[model samples]
Target: MNVNGGRPQLSGTFGAVSSTHWLPSAAAMAVLEKGGNAFDAAAAAGFVLQVVEPHFNGLGGEVPIVSYRASTDRVQVVCGQGPTPASATADSIRRLGLNQIPGSGLLPAVVPGAFGAWMRLLAEHGTLPLADVLDHAIGYAENGFPLLTGAADAIEVMAPLFETEWLESGRVYLPDGRPPAAGSRFRNPALAQTYKRLLREATAAGGGHQAQLAAAEDAFYRGFVAEAIDSFVSTTEVLDSTGRRNKGFLTGQDMADWRATVEESAQVRYGNCTVHKPGPWSQSPVFLQQLALLDGFDLRRMGLDSAEYIHTVAECAKLAFADREAWYGDPDHGDVPLGTLLSAAYTEERRRLVEAKAASVLRPGSPDGRAPHIPEQVPDVLPPSRDHWMNQIRNGLPTVVRAAEARTDTCTIVVADRFGNMVAAVPSGGWLKSSPVVPGTGLSLGTRAQTMTLEQGHLNSFGPGRRPRTTLSPSLVLRDGKPVLAFGTPGGDRQDQWTLGFFLAVTEFGLDLQSATETLAFHTDHFAASFTPHEAHPRKLVVERDCDPGVVEELRTRGHEVELVPEQSLGKVCAVGVDRERDLLLAAASPRGRQSYAAAR
Candidate 1:
């Protein structure tokens, strides 16, 4: 049906790359053309995204990666989501006169993990030198690139705060004492210099590729970058969503103590494909849980985008996310009953909850006879309105309302090389609007700690050195024990839901990547959000305006508070896959935001 007009699904035998921005996609393809594999291409593209999509991600952000290496014939997850500081306890936070963690400023800062995670990927799997992988990003930061309208709008919206409270940010974003115009060439010399210095130090101490990568990691986590972060965070008190200024708890020790780890992926078999995700620490498992529930239904019989299909998917999402709020947390800190959660018996028990009409309540089931517990402070019902500043800080993504509004969210990258290796990564947090730019560093600390709750004994309760259950999730699919597809998107809590729709379209409805990406998208905000204030809009089902009016009305009649957004406003999904049977690489990117692109040789 050419739902997305004429955007071609790129296919090649050499390599394919798809990312949230054109520059990153180009950079990744360039790496592949230069003989780099999927892992190397992914690392190169990831760094460039930190430069071009500053409004969406930065050096201080977090990224959770799912990759399939052909050599090992294994699917693994890289845990880039950093843990809270050793001093950041629930008691310490409450002592600061705050019930919930603020969404912005230093109080919610964690040990920045993006750089470490990328370095780990490169050192363990990549063949290229650190300098080679980072060159494209450094060039963009130094020479400047055309500013995205969304980035410009974010700067404009935060200009008052920058000028008054965050002077360091003003010095960078407000280059001429004002926000740069959209489409104008914008540069971040400070960021460029930061990258250059890291490279120089790495080169000076380098022995080989691995040694240089290790040196770069040390430079960021234990050397000058750590020193800068420590000094700034300890000395500065900044305004946040709590309506007060607070100093951060993070220290140089926190950064030094943290390292990205490669762990086994959580998997669930659906039809012929075995879907994999990160552990319960992230919201990744919700994807598998949803699939488990849907495995009972014949979605092909229900048809695509039909009222029946939308209802079933939305209901399953609500149930799965309820489990996320009740049970998902860092496995390193506590027990997460992932095995029981994905069990077929549990699936059948939960699948029965999906009825003829929409369920307006948030229902989390008992896994293995264990009762579910959510934070007591989290409201079951949505409030009419919230504080403006609190709303602004929720997801760290920025939005500016105008005649043609500009909104920037997270970033996604997926890569596939001819060697059968594939990578899917979602890089988010540390947005320019989320917190003040640290002095001397061109990046800001992430507000991911805001996802932690103060409710003690709860699975996701706040604790020192504990990892926050983040919303950044990436997906990888394998058929017959071979990696075939890698895909992800850039919505915070809605990430899994959006990508689930794309996956179902392809696997169940026989749609191609581009067509599946353009399919009408919908998600239920029926569970508490992972962001600060953790609000839930009960029974709310938001669909793109392009959705059939009949379907929208049907959902409303079934007890959903249907809200319609503009066309192409839901998810910016990017994907890459290998047609193993045909020996071809395939790639596609969402055309919604006019930013994401797909490239192939």
Candidate 2:
């Protein structure tokens, strides 16, 4: 009867299925089906993610989870992303001119505590035994899970970065003298050994939930892994002296002080649906604010493919992203005016400046202080035209065949049991081959440097001890004081953007979860910011095929840099649903992944 038994573990109302790279979604749902709560399912999935989606998540990554209590209707946000070592400093990497930090794994990497976050969640909400919850992962690592297309592609492209640098990496990734192919079974005995030791240590400590998590955190920070990582990092030129990034002095003390915080949600109410996202760690809220301002306009009147609609949204996106570039950063270190940015008064003022049926020139500048009066519309600054957008497909698109799809993996698991408990979790920003594991302990440290800006003082600028701005946003949608939808995506920075669009399609457009999620779309900045667009997709509206040609030409006339890409190009979302009225739970992974699926009861 154990979900962790030899058969494929699964749970949920509709049975779990998905396109996620991690196999843990099935394990978690199975835990719930076998009488485990959402927490148990999440823990089971968390453990499996470490085994199957190893390059992205492990004992060393960070986690941010969203939980909804069915009884009290309380929604809680748990910060899962870990912080930089206390000793880290911005000055340490000054010579690299900040750019080193953005593309950096060696100089700007921080202490990852994804497992620390998971440990806390499981201890607080799980009913299954810790060892039992970890069984699916252990089995996979001991036996082997095939390298699906997504993960394999990543290895082929990025493995050279690791194989040439670390021996252990070369061994784990190139066991047969090449990266594992799709359907080629892969096992990680080293990671299994690490998890085994950690579980044993946690179970032995014996304590309440908080204490249990604390004990597990201790296992990695001050125990065996710490000693090993400290030695490995110091001898290598991975970090600098301050332990800010791959500072040469990675110490147990640094890892011990690493903490994850759960912050309040940034909320947007459009009609009956209230969109929610974690505070400034991501750019989702800023986008939401822009959407609220645009609510007063008639998007349908502008039409779907009209140049007016696309240009309006594009300009708004540019403005929002500019603010993100300027003011978004770790809240602990900087003052982000999130409250003021989303204020209705400011939104109303912004709405007033829009030109009806036309486009305006976009200037990159910070929003001014709140003004008492709405601004007059300035005309002819930028000319707009009626450009029709070609919808490649309104529903689903044929994903472009990609040779680069292999380097990524992520899993999202949502749970709602009879008790009304709900959880949404997405792990790892996908360090992949960038971050090498610590010898013996398999400590795959967080490689968050990739998401941050290297420019000095930019909100997302990389600093020694600051958490990098990430797009890994796990969210919960509460309707009528009840949690209705819980979801997240796995496309690095694409997570927040895609999530914001889904929230809008559902709340503003009145679509159901499936309809909302299935809506083919373009990212806010299109391909300007998130360059990983889907030009190869057959059904999605990408820059190349669907822009009505006239729309692109018109936009180009206005000084906008437009390119074609597919909506599902980079961000593949995995979601779980709860139809509380029907007493049904729907769990499904994206079909994009060859091996991904959901099994629930």
Candidate 3:
């Protein structure tokens, strides 16, 4: 009955695995136990998450990874976010009488990017073969595993749509023409076959580990999987969130032309600690911005769960997120003033907005005399929500509507091995409810195209072969040039906000990993969302119900539109930290959803 009741900090001298799903956590630990390093464990864990948490992620999703190699003594990023199809354009959507990309459908489909990223990680950094790492996921998919109640309920909720609009999905998810009951064994033999064929193709190529990994990547993008995806989307027009039937623009060529890229980690130093995140394409920089703004305040003096601490952090989040809307996007698209935006002077100038009360306006600083590119109209098509769509899957409880809107959901994985290798990855997109299952493949195309904007000249504007500005941001932290932490969560817009809270809990309040994760978290919907319509609810703050009532009252008095969420229902953060000085690996997973797990030793 303790609100702070999460698994104790999982400590070990060998290795650790923490993930959004327990099945994957166990899989990763098993891999580590088999002498695989962090990359191998993470890759294995990520694939397992795709199979078990279909409502959240899949192989068809995107996975952005930040990893540290003990040999290289460096942090690197794998940009798994896929670009729009060659034919994707605003005019094309306009021709279909749509102003924004549909939240769910084929029209918003992008090149499946996760499989490529995972393969690349395994090929470049992992010691295990593609077949060894993937066998764990294939086993569960083929032999069957217990379905989470939330995933089962999701299938049930969408049964009507799947039955009539997305028959392919109905066949894949509801093999018996009915939703799989929670706790009942559910199998996806199609996906298992798909993995088996990929492994066989790679093995048949007769090559070394790297070459075989290359063959697996080739097989997925240039072989059968791509053909199946292309054939289904090219011929089938399915109903989507836009209330219309539409076919996808993705082609085999798009998948072939697209591959995950390696990039330098975006970083900012705060009090001897350098936090690293993916580039402008993700909402990660906001965490750094928040830290900069908070540098002028005495967070520890205010206390961890104090009203002043929560209010100040929430206000800084608003300012940082507002800038995310105005500026953050694919850096390759055009010039992004990241240097000026993350500058200390910029934070000092923007820091003045955080007064005693919440500021309701969207204020993005004009950096280097360039006016911010704020969207003119933000339709609240599917506004942000804290609804527990997969509550049953996580809690084995009935559905509860906490909000009136929705967006894409994701999952995360973090691994640390005895050799000092570490990895943090957020694998997302291709939610079962987001799009139809590709016929005969048990794979669903991602709707990441919804993250694009229609505004021409904007960094996130819809364009062919341009990566959409994604919300899938993972973070890695280093102290004294050594990898110390690898962590992330699955909340779309709330990802950075919650991550910042966890970081502060460690650095400022000195809470352990488990305690930090279980600490009461609050989120603000004051800035634009990354999903379709990109709705913004100015001054809105949703605090966990377990948060002190006095803090809630204080926030309300400070001009915040306070909404209380049920206890253990906000962010699902899973994190792992390495304490080399003590020869120990520490890990923690949020109990909010009950599915997150941490395994060590």
As for lDDT, the candidate ahead, 2 or 3, is 3
lDDT of 3 by residue, 375-423 (tens): 7654534333343332221111112123432222589999999999999
Candidate 2, poorest ten consecutive residues by summed lDDT: 388-397
Query: Which whole-number lDDT from 0 to 100 does residue 304 have in model 1?
Result: 92
Candidate 1 lDDT (Cα, 0 to 1):
0.87
lDDT for each residue of candidate 1 in 288-341, tens digit (9 for 90 to 100)? 999999999999999899889999999999999999999999998888999999
For model 2, the stretches where C-alpha displacement exceeds 4 angstroms are 1-19, 96-99, 159-163, 207-210, 238-249, 300-309, 353-411, 453-461, 524-562, 566-570, 593-600
Local accuracy by lDDT, each model: 0.87, 0.58, 0.84
Give the lDDT of residue 586 in candidate 3. 91
- The residue-by-residue lDDT of candidate 2 on 3-110, one tens digit each, is 121222233553443335546766776676777777777767877876777645666666778887665567767777766555555565455343233232444456
Better of 1 and 2 by TM-score: 1
Off by over 4 Å in 3: 1-6, 378-408
On TM-score, the candidate that comes out on top is 1
Worst 10 residues of 1 by lDDT: 378-387
